[model samples]
Target: MLGPKIREIREQLGLSQKQLAGEDMTRSYISLIEKGRAVPSQRMLKIIAKRLNTPMEYFLGESTATDTDIGEAVLDKAKLYYKERNDRACIRMAHNVLTLTKDVLDQTEAYLLIMRSYNRLGEYRQALDNGEAAAFIVTRTGDRERIVQYYLEMGRAAFHSELFHAARKFYEQAYTYSSRLKYLQDEHIRALIYLGTTHLRLGNVDQGLEFYLKAEKEARMAGQPELYGEITLGLGKAYYMSEQDGHMQLSYDWTKKSVDSYKLARSESYVLALHNLAVIQLHMGQKKEALPLLGECAGIYDERNLPHKKASILEEISKIYLEERELQQAETVIKEALQLLELRDEGVLRAKLYRLLGLVFHEKDNSDEGYYFLRMSHDLLKRIHAEREADISHQILQLSKQKQKMEYDDYKSYIR
Candidate 1:
């Protein structure tokens, strides 16, 4: 029974007797064992079981699970780890599934899980590689749904990596595949929404709006409010990019609507939308309106324990104080943002904060202290190879030679 079972599984996995024998045993030995003309020793059995991803107990009649059952069991554990948000463990389990099964669908599932886990962990390169592997396997299965899913995941990974052209290609593939399947309306909507956002990011405002409008109609018919939120966000971006005189007002209104929808869905996107709305208000010279929105975002970041996000809000608030010539308030806010930045190595934001602090000191007529902070900012920017570092270095050298205070415009070159 064991000999026949081994041969059956090996054949099912598309392994020839010679390949199954490996280097540890001869092809003739494998043939003999399969024909029951010879028995495999314990050592050989261990190697065979490992290669076939089978439990040794099964060969000894201590277990009854089929080879496919074992592969599925491993896959299920990987899924469980993914659902628990244990990304590292999920990746490990998925890799185990990859080695244990030769089934195309099972292999595709394992690759998809690994890709998603890598994406969540911010390993976009790994996620993209795994997504590609899954796409190859999914193609062999001719599973249109799986093909669409893999394309979407690949698009997301590429988008996060800022490879917008690659992302657009992947999303286009997903859109094409999903359109052919009548039951994949939800996937079709998703592909459209992502395509719209990608086009907008690539500066194709008209194309983006066209895609968003199409997705909006589909989402409404599907009764998917969550997807509708994405459409509204895309519309906000489109309106903001419009050359019309009321573009800012249109952006504000659409962004505000998106914020409300995201809030109802209890999504983290709500905070981002609110932050964008506040920025628009500032651009429109409604500082009073922007302040309260920044305050709300700061509160949310505090509750979420996201120090970097909170620091960003503080930096924005301090800018308003600086513009108003409230030097003391600006100094205090800048210092608070600096303290938060110290908790992490945010080189760009840290440099900006230092530059701002230096400006505050220069305004107070403390030239020496102001120069010290400005020097620190310049050095940090150079270390990070910031694009404006060369310009800032020249300006700093001039300030050092003349022992003169820098004007507000001098620091404006310090692009965030």
Candidate 2:
């Protein structure tokens, strides 16, 4: 009965023996267990029970056959909803099934899947909330790998929210777990890169550069060019943020290296590298060189149906137009960018777009519009307490006031 049940549940869950095998179990061991040639240990039984969405009692042959039929029905509906990308529905169904069977471990994994779906949908705050809940449950059960993965997902959510410090903390926790386990080398490298990038965002250039370089070397030694590309992009961002003349050149060089590595790996990192290089060129007063790269980035993002990346490229194009003193062109590009913002609900990115729009209007001598958008940006920045963004807002307010006062004085002189 246990052997047939194991095989039945495995097939229903669409999981192969290879997928169910972990550190302590091999595919052959799983096959042996399912064939009734070997009885599983208590822990292994629990693992299989969680994977199959069935209670351990089912395998113990204590449950009535009717229970298996009902459990399979619930699992089938959950699988269908998950396949349809209806994550919330899938989570609800999975939770209800777990309630019926007391399958805490399976419920925890289901919640993680829901959290990932939220992340994919650009619901970072909700994703973080769900991930924290899942992490707590998994950690209490002593599921080390799941705990590590939960922390990594939480870090990604924090990073998206612009909580650089919080993101770094979570990534560090993930790194500790991965290091102690010594088996998840890919995850370890990813944690290192994420931590380094967060440090760069927090203005710790030297430390960030050090971490990025270390990650790059480790990735290369591991023969993982994708990881190498990711770390190089971090290094390039660090150099770009240094805002020093020589560092700008270094930024371009690193960005080029990142692009080359990503291309070799046949990854999406190439698009990101192109965007970063364009930003560097725009800052370096090479608008002509930046525009073509921005166009390429925009096209790639659009092709991939990534509205966030497209919005970012549009904002960069607005900056180039503003720098060139083509105010009308800047305004047009900003409007297009704002349209992209409607597709997703990311407050930080929206705030940034508003700030860029404000700058564009201010350069166009439209003080009223400029001040309005600037104030909107400031309000959003204040909510996040983004100090660097707040500083930029403050500068914009000061300039707006100065420009207004100058216009008033000129009007008075004309009346005299």
- Deviation in Å, model 1, residue 144 alpha carbon: 1.9
Clashing pairs in 1: none
Best by the lDDT measure: 1
Going through the candidates in order, what is the number of backbone clashes in each? 0, 0
Error of 1 at 213 (Å): 2.5
By TM-score, how accurate is candidate 1? 0.64
Candidate 1, 1-416: lDDT as tens digits: 77898998898889998788754455766877788866564456778888888888888886443655777899899999999999999999989988886666677788889988998886888999887666656665445666788888899998877677789999999998788466778888899999988877665677888888888777776655566767788888777765568877888888888888888888887887888788678767888888899989999988987787788888888777777778899999989988897764366567767777877788778887887787888787665444344345447646644756655565543422
**Candidate 2 lDDT tens digits, 220-321:** 777767778888888888887665569878888989888998999999778999899888887777877988998999899889988878988887776656
Scored by lDDT, model 2 comes in at: 0.73
Off by over 4 Å in 2: 1-93, 100-104, 161-166, 200-210, 399-416
Error of 1 at 88 (Å): 1.7
TM-score of each: 0.64, 0.73
lDDT of 1: 0.77
Cα lDDT computed for each candidate against the true fold = 0.77, 0.73
